[model samples]
Target: MAKSTRGRVNAQGDGTSGLGMVVRFTPKARSEGVQQLEKGGFRVASSKDFRSAVAVPNDFDGADVQYFERFGIAIVRRDGERLKPMLQNAMQRKVISAARPERSYRALGGPQTMRLDLAQVGGVATSLDRDYLLGYRDAVNELVDRLLGKKGAEGLVARAAFDETSNTWGLQAIRAIEGDLSGAGIKVAVLDTGFDETHQDFVGRSVTKKLFATRSSEGDVHGHGTHCIGTACGPLRPTSGPRYGIAHEAEIYAGKVLGDDGFGTDRSVIAGMEWALDEGCHVISMSLGAATQFGDAPSDDYEQIGQVCLDAGTLVVAAAGNESSRPQQIAPVGSPANASTILGVGAVDRPFVPASFSCGGLNPGQEVDIAAPGVDIFSSLPDDKYDRWDGTSMATPHVAGVAALIAQSDPKFRGWALWARLIQLTKPLSSPARDVGKGLLQARGSGEV
Candidate 1:
């Protein structure tokens, strides 16, 4: 695991007391099967409209098995092990396809979530001195190592700021997007911690939010979701710092898969996926994932579901994970991202150098599909504010926003073609393929819609 950012993850109490178990049904889930399961004292609700996939009232009663009818999958919630056999029976009764316990997912970013530093997620109000010290220490260590020609430093220096302009350096690197394309017609769903409806820049925009995690509503308290949403779909002419959003004119789908604590379960994420698919979002951007040990295969359920998203004309992208600290160690791509069908994105600093903490394509079949600027990225925060942060979590949205742009440019770019076009347009980098897959992302010369 090489000091993985993804250690075992568990969900905060959703005012419920039980375990979350995921079950996939045969073909499309049948009404009789769902009704029968509901009758078994297992109430399920994850804002899923089995008919059209719209966000409805999904207030938790006891525990709702997060159901995704689009994929015939339902995350079963039951007290104790009482209904284990019934679930097993369903697999026999032709209602269930596959079943497994839900794994934990978290908002991936530079901040070691275990510490929960506000500045790490770009909260401008709370700046602790220790944050500076730690950042400096890591920066100095890597800088000196690179200077001394020791370790795997690669003679790279981490910059304090990527750009001095009013936009993020990531947007600067992919300057081609600023032309005519603004992702006006695309819909991007960011399934992470909830979003901040109070953010000033996003006011009056076409933003839709839904809570899959246990929370009062679709709001960001942990700050990761707001930051990620800002990078992916924030405003272009904001009343703030550099422009951070990619698909500035695109509709925003903020799915609160991870709770305010920045942690979520498979139940929340999968349920969110269902909701996004139902909403007909063109791109589903997930800057969240679970850790994976070496030799760990990607989740069968996630892999299948990712392919399903692609088959349905939506592209799913995820953080390759900030699990590895380079110069001495490297880690496998994380779960969900590690899944072959999902596009895994690694992180590079503003200098176009692979981040010391960015995981690589060490695991077979879990190769990093792309790389993007993730270091010291400045973006919107909750209280009409902005700050700089780091991690592959930041990189995932950059690619996702680009996907939306390419999707809007032409209809043919949907599904895997979008992936192919992106690969075709990347500017080659000197970094190893394992670190920067297909090179840095570049916007097409013309966004001819």
Candidate 2:
């Protein structure tokens, strides 16, 4: 086997002491045997057999197995390994990876579980073949190499943050944040699509939090939020060093407000903000923004809320909407972000060139704060993995994480003091005309800047 890139297992005490076992079933069989196995007192876990097309959570013990004409197979995950010998004898064997890693943080009030991953499921004969299974393993091996490969070839790292030679702007952002204060005791609240809580970069360090803004209590449904979180707080495991997030050791409060479709309501976002504040989070990073503009009354509501945040002393950083230009000229950014007091961020390329997708002066000639590398940034993904994706959404957290670092360096700064310090520390890039407010964000800055 090629060098296995194992995830950092949190092994303080006895590992695998948890009770949960996975079992595979035999290949296509004409008999209603699986049902008989279920009837014999076994619980059904999860099934990803493409042959059978049903994906839902239902209890299946003693009566869970059913044979369908569509695909003649019976597969199930049971509670214990009581029937391991029977299963090994009856079905062709394949490998299994833990579906869910043994999580360190449990829900406020929930059950402890160690879920198993169903890596592959096929005909027992073909699946059991050593070469065939090895071939499948090879594909996975390639994905891991791509995920961690520094040299640009077929890996996600190379795809997102490397050009043939060096790290891209997104990777640079990762470096900046990771450098000075990855260990700051700050929490960056990320509300986006779902994150892969199972990945190695996040291992024992991740702390899941609810986003009251989401319609459902589900975590990031889409992968966007997870990647962004990686930028803000991806844990540094052994194989991956210097790859840690800016606030690498900082606590992450994941709030999956965006659904699988990547669309969320303003109400949901507002709720997420409130939750973050309630938790006493000093810095909240919102890589999301509204595509449409708000009218006077709605705008006023936003300003009022922004002032509330100011009074309560939390920094709400939002993306300047990606939509830009003439016919569809979106005005003065969007709700929440457009609020006079809240910081509205626009994107600039690596060379300080404004991204075409980055919305321009909504409140022209006014202070736009600072700009950082935002085009394509590399960040953490679910599992022991990584990916490079683009969006001002990804960029916002770089600054927010920096805010966490600053707080860690000097804990006295809170509310307006923190916001003022950020603005005061910013190095102005644009002159009177083209670039309005500040240049890029500088971690070590002269208070006079």
Candidate 3:
């Protein structure tokens, strides 16, 4: 943890990462205090109601309050009304913390070679010159690799450990090739843009889905979610490509939190978390993130939500946002993933080197917890198509799927139990813990007794 970023959490959001306010209850509210909730002036939202709580339904004079019983949290919204009185009233008894603005987080990856449009990544600053330089430098490096046998910063080993004849290089690198491919009884929630519910590859698999974001339905138009889902819980043997998925038998719970345009607010993200818990999902995999600045504190609301969710027996795995142009700059891990309890995942390439854009734990307590193959990774996309992409976003699901396998292999793996085992199973790399954390992820092989 860096000294500059240490200290009290910015639970108020600071309106930098997002807009709208999210309220978390104190420990006292855990007793199911109906009176405290009622007096706080909020009604329990229906389990099926995944609407944005910030939209003040019916022109209420003050703030519109909706209490979600599942998480013991409230969302208060006032379109144009005074908020101090209402907030003070709740803060007096029910609200432990309240934050402003709901950040609009985006899908964290795109085309294989540094294709991130820095402008859309909001909050995380990276110059256009840096992006151009990254591309030019990488191009020159590739040219060098071609002219003079494969050699670069990582240097040439006897032979690189990558080939996709039998499976995707990612699966091979992580040793998921021979690992447990069956997560039969485990339920994994992939909370993102949603999955291709009707994609040909998933024909007969049991996939449950819901729309937390206001979209026509839960189908994904942004391809990123489909790619992520395919990695976490796609088919054991795809219709065409080499084996790319893990936990093929794991029941898929697809929650559409980010919409078609690849953007969603904090409200939708939290709603997805609550729904995943309500469905008893064993693992929640999020490949989305809101940008964060150096020394910027993480959301206390998210921190509390993460702790509560973990205690409830579900582990949340999220991407360490691709907000860096390393060597030139390294950014802090983004929100939700930076929420201490959530497993923050970073990206590594074929050489086991950290991806250029992979964010680091520059902020206090925001360290990367794990690493997985994320660069030039092949996986399913929407409409039955497939392609390679890059980002820490790609690494997260690899960890989530593996966690599901661990959960199925042993019934006791949940929350921190699962968290610890995953860390314990990693293969140490040369990279710093700040970049690769515990190290490269290795599946608890199917052959393991």
Query: Using lDDT as the measure, what is the rank order of every candidate, best first?
Result: 1, 3, 2
**Candidate 3 least-lDDT 10 residues:** 1-10
True lDDT of residue 323, candidate 3: 91
Q: lDDT for each of the candidates?
A: 0.75, 0.50, 0.75
TM-score of 1: 0.80
Q: Candidate 3 — which pairs collide?
A: 18-101, 18-103, 19-101, 19-102, 20-101, 20-102, 180-446
Q: Best to worst by TM-score, what's the order?
A: 3, 1, 2
The regions of model 3 sitting more than 4 angstroms off are: 1-19, 29-63, 92-95, 113-161, 215-217, 445-449
- Model 3 C-alpha lDDT per residue in residues 423-446, reported as the tens digit of each score: 888887766889989888888542
Q: Which stretches of candidate 2 lie over 4 Å from their true place?
A: 1-180, 211-217, 236-244, 292-298, 325-331, 364-367, 431-436, 446-449
lDDT of 1 by residue, 1-449 (tens): 21221222122222254446566666754565677678887776634443343333344444566567666666665553655666666666767666666667888884432233465455365645654654665677567656865532122343433345676778877664457788988999999887886789988889888777854355788889888888888787878677788788999988888877888877678878878888899999998988888877677677779889999989999999988979789988898898888999999875576888888998788889988888777787787878777889999999988888898888998888888888877777667989988888777553642
